[model samples]
Target: MLEEEYQKRRVLPRHLRKQTEPERPFSYEIRPATLEDIPDIREIYNYYVRNSVVTFDEKAWSHKRWREKFEHLQKLGLPFLVAVAPTGQVLGYALVSPWASKSAYRYTVENSVYLGQAATGKGLGRALLEALIEASEQIGLRQLVAVISDKGAEASIALHEKLGFEEVGRMGKVGYKFDRWLGTIYLQKQLNPRKKPGILKRMLGAGASEE
Candidate 1:
């Protein structure tokens, strides 16, 4: 099968994760983040970057640049979330930043979700995103985007579709790694007026690091 075709066929349950589900009451909390969250966030992100196609960076990042990424997120009013276990282990995180810098594209944002090796499939991703959406929609973002790597086309794509993002676009050959061409999948969802982003929502991130 063609790579894109093969991925479109994969789905992650076709059901969105909800608060009252049996997986309810997980011991983690998702909150906005800052510079202190970088090392743990790097550990979560690098795990996937090294072993999987979840991110398309051509090389592993150094500490300085990694810290810079999160810093940029903070300035954009994006919620760089950390899903923390009761003991304060950083399980995973999700963040969204400007899809484009020009004012015309201000309402659009692309996102990233990364989890530690031990945290996959335990519903931490869902929790992190649930919190992310609540935080982002409060500011004024009209839409949210997930740029899925071609190799992970199944799980992440499926999850986004179930969460209401439609497959709006894709770009081929823009990413090269592991001796192959990888594509980018763009998914989006509209926000209700009642859920529009608010100023206070940005403040929610200020206290994100908690024990």
Candidate 2:
């Protein structure tokens, strides 16, 4: 019996013979962005800035710039979210900022989503953007716009279209970067209308009632 068992073990696949533990699945959580996540987010964005034409900006954003943007979004009560691995790495981020500076465009916002080089192709972008959309709806945003590069951003354009953003317009040679002229494709999504009064309106109503 012992000789037979040894022969069986010898013929078994090496991996099967070792009784190894199964690898933990790749998983992450989508959550509201915090101040601590800014550095990781900056790194992700700068990677694209340096390596691709996905963004028209030719220079990397400084930490100060990122912080300023973060604060600005917070002041506007907009959605800025992150996808974090179980190891606490920021895998990607999605955010919305006012589409235009004027009050008339308050309900409309432009959206941006970016993932780390190693974090792409794993559906993190979709999750982050979906979460951003849900959060924007919850906060009474009416529209979200995505400006994608006409070059080297087919995946981004496809992802936005898959999430219900329609092709609204396109501009050619509007941006010059990396010693070449690049264009933008504009995609817009109309969010679900708000069902309740916005915070400002609610506050005003409460004040009137108190008086």
TM-score of each: 0.77, 0.84
Off by over 4 Å in 1: 1-26, 193-211
Clashes of 1: 6
lDDT of 1 by residue, 82-191 (tens): 88888878888888877764455566778777778778888777777777777777776787888888776588788777778899888887787778888888888886
What's model 2's TM-score? 0.84
lDDT by residue for model 2 (88-160), tens: 9999999987776545566778999999987889888888899899998887878899999999999999999
Would you give me the overall lDDT of model 1?
A: 0.73
Where does candidate 2 have its weakest 10-residue lDDT segment?
A: 202-211
Q: Which candidate comes out best when scored by lDDT?
A: 2
Give the residue spans of candidate 2 off by over 4 A: 1-22, 195-197, 200-211
**lDDT accuracy of residue 174 in candidate 2:** 96
TM-score of model 1 vs. true structure = 0.77
Error of 2 at 58 (Å): 1.0
